[model samples]
Target: MIFPLTVDRVFADRTRAEIGRSVLTVPAPDGTHVVLGGHDSTGPEDGYPIGVYATPAGEGRAPGLADDLPAVGWLRTARPLRAAAFHPVLPLLVLGTGSYDGGYFFEGALVLLDLASGRRRDLFADDCLREVRSLQWLDAHTLRLLLAPHDDWEDRAARSEGHLVDLTRSDWRAVPARSLRPEDLCGPRVPALLPQPTPPFATPDPESPRPGHIRSLTELPDGDILLTADHALLERWSAAGDRRWSLPADPRLSGGPLAAVAADGASAWVEARGDWRRESGTFIRIALTDGTERERHTTPGPAGLLVSSGIPLLVPVPAGYGELSRSLFRHGRHAVFRDTPRAACTCDCPWDDDEECACACACPLCAGDSMDDEEVWLTVVEADPAADPTRLAFPGTERRRQICPWSWEPGETHYDGPGVWIGETDLVMATVRYDGAVRVPKQGFVTRRPIGEDPSGTPRWVFPVDRTATALDIDPSTDTVLVALSDGELIALDATTGTLRARGHVHVHGVPVIPTALTVTGPGRLLLGTSDGRVLTCRPGPG
Candidate 1:
């Protein structure tokens, strides 16, 4: 059941150029070829056809970031990726993808990809069969497929399609349905998004403020909360649970969703994008007093809130290149051209002057890849938009490490999680560790580090949580670190000692929600954002 998949770097670049998205990867059973799944821009009327391709399964190579692999075979089928399985003994593959059509039928395709001949054929030409839920091989000559019903809206008896195909047959469409064996049906495989249940420490406030995906929130100097919603809506709420003023959604700012907001005096900076896929965005300056636009300017790339010395400035935000940016932050590597070798040098020394390193190894500083190679720096961004604005980068030591799937080399550690600013130059970050593709969060440790100087020295303190931290904030007055865990627990910790102080449950309307963002409005008072698009004002009573 385990078919390892290597990174297909060229597939995304190629798909993006064709105005499409590459979403799924299915490696062949024999491990010589792999199948790619996605949709292209030009498609038929039914829907976006799933573009399937078989490419060579390159093994042992370093998987160069720039090398492009040509497709050995191709199949364009309607619908997205569903279930796909390769024949146990032949050079044949079967896949199905589709959903309930708006009409009375569930229209989809059961496609077969022939690796030996580079040809594709659909088993069914009509819109009667539902999506193929699972594909399995009973033997070398027997292939089994389980499909959903064509229509299941009425009170009729539930029906499912199961077919045991004879590989010797020329046409699969004529194969009659038969009763499935226990081995032919697969159990629940795809996970559903369900809320994690937890005990409620605080009762739900019936009059909770309803906001649609609170993207960014900040407490103003006068206790007003300025926040942005899913689209371009900007709103201000008073301390006494009242909506002060809301700016209507503007079509001019419809580049993309509003990413973040940073308040400075009477003006607030609201970042709006045409879309996350675009390279440029706009930062609109709006008056906090009346929700009116003051001014705005176009930014070069995706910009986010970066706080330095209590001053919020717009800075470049890492898109999907978290591992690459982290390597630059820690190792000071700078060249990202496709031609540069990933293992150019094995020096364990930081760059001395950008021309060379202190180690005797011919350092590849010039040909290295980096975010900013000028000096050591500590850059921090909130796991969510509203946790805190803390970005720190200083000179750091180089450590040879294992690579996460996202990194280009085997030297970068992925700490791309929430961080809360605890001091002028110190913050606590949730570190992520990977064992190949499996995330090892239990072995992960939370470390507090100073960002104003060389970070090679021992950290101030280290602690382990054994769980993923969804959001992190700090009570500046008490130095108590606030952590919103992914499992619906709100934890408080001593910031200076890294010791657990207390823990409590968090719920929205008596239902547990995974906290996505948090902002401490005041001592014992806070605002919590949930994954289901809710903004709740919470006041923790005694215990």
Candidate 2:
């Protein structure tokens, strides 16, 4: 029986909005204040405008553009920040912004700002060069710069250029520094923000055939392990951790990059993802016996592979700026332009209905205009090799057929992560939280729902966890589902009741282990693929 309930019931716990990332920071020489930089939109396509704020050093708070920070200045660059520097012994600031133009050239400007008088000027005299990788004040009057390549032409020697400018000069023009090398300039590095697996306990010998970064892993029917690494290679490992075979996922032969892999009786199917700008992928079948190529078929966009009842199903993952984009736009934050609604309501209502209602029923400007613009309808692609892949709607949400209306608070963005089948009928899934500039799956929850076509079907229960689950597997003997967390936590939940049965941390030889993949090898025994390119087996007990 289906029971109608409040939208809040859809979530195990209330969701919260996440803060965006900071652009660049330039601190005062005395350290009394810090000039922070960031953008006001989702990306450069939407005329991205970056803002600069001077916050008190002791305040210890990084404020967003929407926050009530004292804005020292703002720039309408329509570009992302690349480098920034504060002038010494002078009331001035230099900010650089640019990025790859999605095509041939890297473009940006070097803006000189007069902090005392609010005056600004673009220092570049012509379009001969762009993109400041770093800046250093050579002295009180001269500034040093390292500009990225003008175009994607060739190697670093041909693309990188450097300049030196004396602000005291009448023109303040930049002159090419012939002796400057790319290594002479330095700035903050782009971090590996995504959660990563741990390295092996000890480094491999220099000559060992190293398995690159593991993306995903699964256990084969014959007790062997199969995994995709670096989006290029697929390798098989024996039950005892011996390398069986490795195959290259050449884009010409296997779509683009290896994404999802599934195994059948004697064959395995691999999905190679498409480029970010397109919505197509490739599905290739390989022989399990010797890792030989078999057949290939064009498939759907970057998706997950699910095999049930001897059938292969492709679940399409949403592209960029999905439902969360709408929420961000509604709350006065930067989001994609298409995601912004044509209209919205400001009144408080229990439900968004337009007819037979008492609240704003006749108002055309009410909030009842279907809040389902970009809702991702869960679907599956057929396994036809000679015909176009047909998309059939599965048991997920669609436009105006929401199973769980969003109940997240302002500033919080939510994302559904990977899932696993607990039994023949019930499906276990995880929802992650967006933090800073990336989605931090470590901060999410788990839920279990039965297989059905009802859009409003309620889940069996929702189990909120403090850490995000990186992988999941079932221990059929104990009727328990094991969740492997990115931070090395192993949680066992009752498959029938959704109750937490046990919690343990994964460690090896006193070294903390970060798990990237996991599976139940046997009764009470678990196998894990770590970020450090190593496989380990452990039995959770009182340790």
Candidate 3:
């Protein structure tokens, strides 16, 4: 379903605004309206009711406005809904909420509602259920819900849990097969800390809260669930609520709560939010494994990661906008393979003292940056098949460095855009320059070096695409590069010869489209995500 505006974008200005409290107006059949109440961040005394509002057609939109008329609709309360999940088969809306005391510490609930008639039924309202952060429909009647205990709860009580609720069950006892916890699922135990003493005979202070609840949950192809917690921890949970793997934060790597999680068959990708002043963040990847330990792969940002058709892509958010900016990274595989950094010399004067500069330092693989340049490097590590236990190895062979020659400026003058992989060998990237008032296209180039290469020398090829190519992807079988322009046109280019192969305009339902995300499903199938949150899948004919 597509909305006129995204939830994030609509409430962009309100950071403290409860994402769950934002009411979503979904149009009902027969041109009537139903108000899907969001989670209430305000205290329970505030009476943020979780219910469905049925309003007459002329009263307002299907997701009717709360301020319409007095007698326009009836309020049906389930539990102050924290999240709503639609059953894959039945026309039911699953509502989630947590317990809340006067000051936000509250256990949540999961309620099932018939969307058509507003008939509500409390599926589970136990005090044992914590905040229902996320819910996914596993099948027709089976639903997976991510739960975290109330805020004021002790660390020992704050275990992450997942419950499989069977909607078809008659008895509530039969609905929940078992409660799955992190410790029960994974082998290694996460470190637990006792509350530190405050001062000499000081009054007992309140407990520090855990990071925000799971920011998002995604299902992997292998049935492993990816849970991104409030504290920037990305844990892999089994369908049975066992923790399969978890990624620890590296000090050198900036971290934040995971904004989103996406996985292809091979690896899972996480988009981590960072400080706005930093102007960058980490896009981490971890292999799907059976242990609680995991490895990390770093990428450039301000960026986000998405997996489509088993290929991982990085979507870069332009500088200055922080989380609000949206731009698509096309040709991500090429960026990973081609623009990775190789060994370099980092002496103050490489030319002045050649012998002193002989020591290996950070240098650009495809393009060399001087010692003074603020550079970002991409390092790609591949699995070594010949190694014992099949461990990942940095071959030192496939590395490329890209030089953003303009990052040294005081204000926001550096150009940033998503990089794409074209064909098998080229890295395509688009960058924009803001000249005070107007933002103009700076340049888009394709890298020439292979995945593993030294970047201290000149690049092999640098072809520029005139218009800003926000999204790019190569076809599954062909060497054609699919480019999504800011103007809503999808163009296919021959990566080998830099020739245009095909072109098509994007449309959703019937409106012109601006794609926020693009993925090549197959040789000709393309999936496009728009700014309005509508996903369009289409097949483009060859030129």
Number of the top candidate by TM-score?
A: 1
Give per-residue CA lDDT, model 3, range 1-543, as digits (tens).
112212111111111122223444333444443434533422211234433444554655433223332222223232454466655545566666554455535455666666556555554433354556556666665566655544544444444433323233332223442343333222222222221212211121143122232333345556555545333346565544455665644443333322233222445555555555233345555555642324454434344444322344443433333432332334343223213122322233333322333435543321344433334343332323344222222233433234332222244332445455544444544444345543234344433334344343234444455455555666757776666665455666666665666566653322344454455655665555443223444564322
Task: Evaluate candidate 3 by giving its C-alpha RMSD to the native, one decimal.
Answer: 20.4
Candidate 1 wrongly placed segments (more than 4 Å): 1-212, 248-264, 277-280, 321-410, 433-445, 452-454, 465-468
Worst 10 residues of 2 by lDDT: 10-19
For 1-543, candidate 1 gives per-residue lDDT tens digits of 001111111100111121023444556665665554543323122233233333434562311213344445554455665667777767777776665566555556677777677566666644344466556666665666555554557813323443333233434333443322334334333321211222221222344332224444566778767766543357787766576776655544431222233424666656553443332246666777798887777755444433333433444443322222221111112210011123223334555444645455554433445633222224333222343433212212231121212221245444445666554455566655444544323345566765545435246787767665656777766777777665556778788898877776653212233455677777766777544344566665531
TM-scores for every candidate against the unseen true structure: 0.46, 0.46, 0.36
Note each model's CA RMSD in angstroms. Answer: 20.0, 18.8, 20.4
Best to worst by TM-score, what's the order? 1, 2, 3
The total number of steric clashes, by the backbone 3 Å criterion, in model 3 comes to 29
Error of 1 at 219 (Å): 1.8
* Cand. 1 TM to true fold: 0.46
Index of the highest-lDDT prediction: 2
Q: Please, what is the whole-model Cα lDDT of each candidate in the order they appear?
A: 0.48, 0.49, 0.42
